[model samples]
Target: MRILALALAGAVLGATSALANGDALVIGNSRYTAVQTLFGAQRVAQAASALNAKGFDVTLVQDADAADMRRAFGEFAELLDDDGGPVVILLTGAFVHSAGGSYLLPVTGNGRIDEAEVLMQGFPLDAALAILSAHQGRAFLVLGETGEDPDLSLYLNAGLGELDIPHGVTVIRGPAMDVARYAARDMARTGRFVRRAAIEYELQIEGYAPQGQVIVRAGDVAPPRGAIDPPLPDPFANRAADDVAWRLAQEADSAEGYQTYLDGFPGGVHVNAARQRLSALNAEPFYRERRAEEDLELDRNDRRAIQRALTILGHDTRGIDGVFGDGTRGAIRRWQEETGLRVSSYLDRDQIARLQAQSTRRAAELEEEEKRQQAERARQERVFWRRVEDRGEEAGFREYLQKYPEGRFADEARAVLKAIDAQRAEQAVGQDRRDWTKATQANSVAAYNAYLRDWPNGGFREEAKQRISQLQLDADRVRNSIEASREEKAMNLNFVARQLTERRLEQLGMKPGKVDGQFDENTRAALRRFQDARGLRVSGYLDEQTMVRLLAGGIIGIDR
Candidate 1:
């Protein structure tokens, strides 16, 4: 309940537009009698400011009384009207989670509040999600509980509550779940980490639609550069660290805005160094030189590059006019910090040369690295299959399938199996020698086939090439085993497959006849009909290829 320090700090500017764009509220309810409330207040204020500078509409309510807490919740509920975003809600307090539900004692309230005052003293997850759903935004609830607390799972089992992240809720207990931890992820500029943690649980719920909507990551770690950016407007209420990191990693503009962020935040954490490095590069004449090269194809030359450099430096470039005039130079210098690089408007050859070289190297390195990784993966796959053949082919293959479901060697394995089985049939009397020789020559291929035969449900699957290799041995007895499993195992239909089949049949002149909970012959017929109408190859099967086309055609409105 220590969110009341706003009285001393003055009402911080609520990033009205930023808040409205993607609302974030840092609620530091430090309810412990030992820990001072001001600590939570300051942390919330800093977090809110950091997020607001990054274009988030943030409200920092520190050390709030119960009435103030309720009012803040109401304001947050209003933010969901237009933006389907994640409204972050942080709580730092004593969490009394009984059979009824988990509750956070308001900071100003006494720690001894009994069960009778649970609803009044604490905010419930259901009420929070309901409010968030009504507002069109997601809710992320981060509960940083202190001291010796009961296991939340107890409450969960007793029907008090469950931590269903995808419903846009994340519940974290223990004083270890601090504002600094979240600040670190945000500082590291990783939001997907936070987003993933928020939504991962609900994504696994029995009947809940696993939209895989939120990206959640926990901890102070930063993701590798150029990793997939988290989805924007994260649909959760209170995000963990990754959410904060991702929000702060966003590019910004204006000297004043950046300076305000720096002022409020003295420590140069995750992004501070990146910002400084960018600023140093920006101040150097060569930074503009690289931009000029990248923009050389465009009509504007030096102007565009200069404007870009200035923007990167957190300077406002009215326009990239090519002319390195006073306005542009002044803006660049204003954006400069403690970097030793001399402030200059003119693009110098040395700086330009270095940036161009670095850029070229980075681009080439990225491409080559991608190719190298792909090749290495291919090589490993070959090796893995080879080992599988040498050992228990079926076991090797099964394990491989589990590890690499869409592996390239999948087809080869199938082919090897066909060959082995064929050799067994041709020389059914003494085909053992052929088996040893084939295993030695094409171990990976042999392993793959064995995997397909035994562990039909294994992660790795046979591709077109492997199936083609097995084409000659169509009548193999193992084929029946493979086909039999697909037919009998009703649970084989993946979530994507089920949704696609259901939605497509519903749209077409057919009412989805009992999603009969399985991919049976009826489902195949429906799939074939849909494929035939679309002029696609209709094999009366829903293969990955078919699923891809279905997705491309927007057969089902589910976001990919």
Candidate 2:
């Protein structure tokens, strides 16, 4: 049991020595739920160290329950009374007195230390006395320091007054170690020694009760290991402007001692005094250099926690030793840069917060950008297909296919190009029919031959060949008829075209009197008769209207 967070009042000079211990028995019990348990193990460690230094073989047990503590005390009593230096049985825990017995608690004791059954569960002073009296060794009984019950001196007087021994049984109570009841009251005697001054000063400090190791110096052998004697020799007692800093840096052997002192007492209450002394002792350089080195072990763990947090934020701290070395500094700087802060090798609370904020923002931006790019790509695809469709030709389809061979509409574009080529082929066939019709109306072998030449494998190729065969036999005949018509024996025809018209009119019931390819009088007379019969003015010359009507009436065998 020890003071919580704060250090105890030091020895006036400092505890440098103690009475030599033979076989020391130290029992620390802190597991009581009914009362305050021991908060820290430092006191137990300190007591053990002091006794071990005095050449006593020390056995320490902590957090022990009732059975384990009883077993320990029984073992202490067994080895304690017989064959060693005077025994020091130091017990540190919760203490209570009821029915004239002092009870030192263990981990599992029911209710309060004052109850009779609870007293049975604890290690009592009477058991300690029985063992000391049984061994031949004069024993010193010690109640060690704890946070609760600093004014517990009456537990000793009440318990011992009921025992069989003389007042020679020396008892010690520690760091608070008060025995004012034995010295100043009815249990008073010239025999008991106590820390009157330190105890008085400790009582003045608020909140926590003061308790310390006690010593009994009545025996001529040596002083016992409790707080009855004056406090031990302290190296930093004279250096104490502040009570805690000396214990922390000088006494507790902690590196954080100086730094923690400076942080808390920066108003120059303790720091300025420490600095003045540092120069005189030439310890300034040592502290300056080892300040970080001597920090609490927890500080290193703290650094590792910070590094792990940074790692989660995507900054690599390289290692986690809790020290802010170059790698850690660089990580901090990088994080500061990413979060849009001034680049630096150090970090404070504000920088860490912003780093997290900026990381979140960057993630959101990247997601948004991805969505935008996807939409743009889709729009481009739409435009590409539309351009290809609006042209609606082979080239338009081919352009789309070349650009986007694996595009969404690639197969459809191929199908469209095939359809366009088929339609063009069908249109070319219709033009071939019109050319054949014009050749048939010319009614000459040359015209028929020309039609066959143009459409060698066309649908009208057979018809053109048959007409050419018929016209080739009349080449001489047509010339003779033309000669006759021009001599006025028959009307002259312009060519075979007029001759064919005369033949068609004659077949339709007009006497043209000639079947020659010339614009003769007979051909004109037949044309007028055909026009008159067909409800037109009998113009002697063939007219455009008459030709159209003749062609429409199938009199002219031109292709429809």
Candidate 3:
């Protein structure tokens, strides 16, 4: 029921399915009511899908009894059609060991025979494999279990421990090298998955090449002509098969060394593939081996793992190498002390697994913390802008310029400033217009002084000066126009006396007119008449005090 998102194109699927492959048979059993098969059933289906896709007419029989399994095996073996290639038998069920070699069990019912009765209840694993291998074509037997013997150590110690099988049987084990395993491990290993068992086998076979290649087998058919080449020193042809096997065996060091061997044997059958693997090997950092007598000190990979773990726990260890010499040990000890685990320099399997898991947990925690911090910074920025705006547009704009001179929103701030400036300028112009009218209507010199105090750089300075000059001229004309009235006569006589002699003008009641703002003879006669009325010598020109009196609302009533 696991949904796998495989990004392989249908074209690849179509191309793989069109390949002419030989016969293949797959057997799977999970409802045995014995040991719960976690991934066994799934693996069987996966195998079947992979084969089918690889242009193989794969026959997948699941949960079969003893009779059914034997019958299917017989039928598959009888297929002698020279169609595409060789016949392949892929069995993924339980293998039981007895005094008579190994046996493939049925779905239910024990394959065990008691002392009272002896019966061949189940098909023998070795016989089944042997029967398929005996054919005049290439054969393969893939299995996961090595042996389930508790005393495996004693057998290994005797140096006589090998579960023998056919020579061409290529075996793959564990929840490794496949998509689900790689994904669960976060290894990013496999890029795709083969849907059919035949295709899976093909891929396994073709994966032995440099580029990724998969092949599947269906029914018994003749193998393709160019598929099985004459064995030689062709590196490209065999690279995938060799690399996958090497990787599975955890012989990365040996595989890397093969790069040198391939380099030496350039004309070998697998030369191209060897060179490719060689290039890959050369790029990888050299991993040196330690002598048996050496101390149980940490290595680079160990240190890297530790560093990665420490980094997760908020300690920024630069790298993770297995070397727990001092820094890594110190970090581990610190983490152990914090987490209440045993504080030790040496890391056991459980400890290492814990460390790796902790590292991942710590990474997620760090990422979350960073996101929170960013959110806080953004909030603070918003608060700052709001506070500035509260101060008023001018202050806000000034603050913005100071804070972010080349900010993305600089243009927006400038626009706000420009609007405020324009508004202030418009208000200043309106006030200046009103001040100009008020200053013109005022008759006193104090009013003009007040207007000048209020508007230092008002726009109506020239207009106000002109209006004041005209008011002075009109006042002088009014005094000159009156010839018979006693006050007018006295004013004219005083004006004349002030105009004629400056000393006499001060003695007289009337002051002299200012020579400014007057051009006609009538203005001169008016000044002369005013001087005569005040009983002083006549002069048309006004004195400094007289001009001050004319300009500053100093009009006086004189005795006739």
**All candidates: CA RMSD in angstroms?**
21.0, 46.3, 41.4
Q: Comparing candidate 2 with candidate 3, which one achieves the higher TM-score?
A: 3
Roughly what TM-score does model 3 have, to 2 decimal places?
Answer: 0.29
lDDT of 1 by residue, 1-560 (tens): 01111321112432212222355556665424322331222344455665554455555554455666676776655543354544555565555655555665565424344445555666665565555454332455555543323223422321223453444344433232233345423422334444344332112221122344332223222232243543244333242343243224322322343354455455533234334323433443444433433233222233344444443333544333332334555665554332345654334555445434543444455446545765786687788877887885644564565445445566665566566555544653334443434433554555556545543543233332244344423334245435544432322343444666667676664444566445566665576555444444445554433443443333422323
Candidate 2 TM-score to native: 0.28
Please identify model 3 stretches exceeding 4 Å from their true place: 1-19, 34-36, 109-119, 135-137, 146-560
Off-target runs (Cα >4 Å) in candidate 2 are 1-21, 34-39, 109-119, 134-137, 144-165, 174-560
**Ten residues in a row with the worst lDDT in model 2?**
1-10
lDDT of 2 by residue, 142-238 (tens): 5543434322343332222233442445455532222211211211112333334324322111111124313322342354445666555555455
List ranges where model 1 is wrong by over 4 Å.
Answer: 1-11, 14-20, 34-41, 109-111, 135-138, 148-161, 164-179, 184-191, 195-560
Model 3 lDDT per residue over 248-306, tens place: 22223234555655545555433443443344335433212111101233333344445
Q: Is candidate 1 or candidate 2 better by TM-score?
A: 1
Model 1 poorest 10 in a row by lDDT: 1-10
TM-score of every candidate relative to the true structure: 0.32, 0.28, 0.29
Residue 271 displacement in candidate 2 (angstroms): 39
- Cα lDDT of all candidates, in order? 0.44, 0.48, 0.42
TM-score top scorer: 1
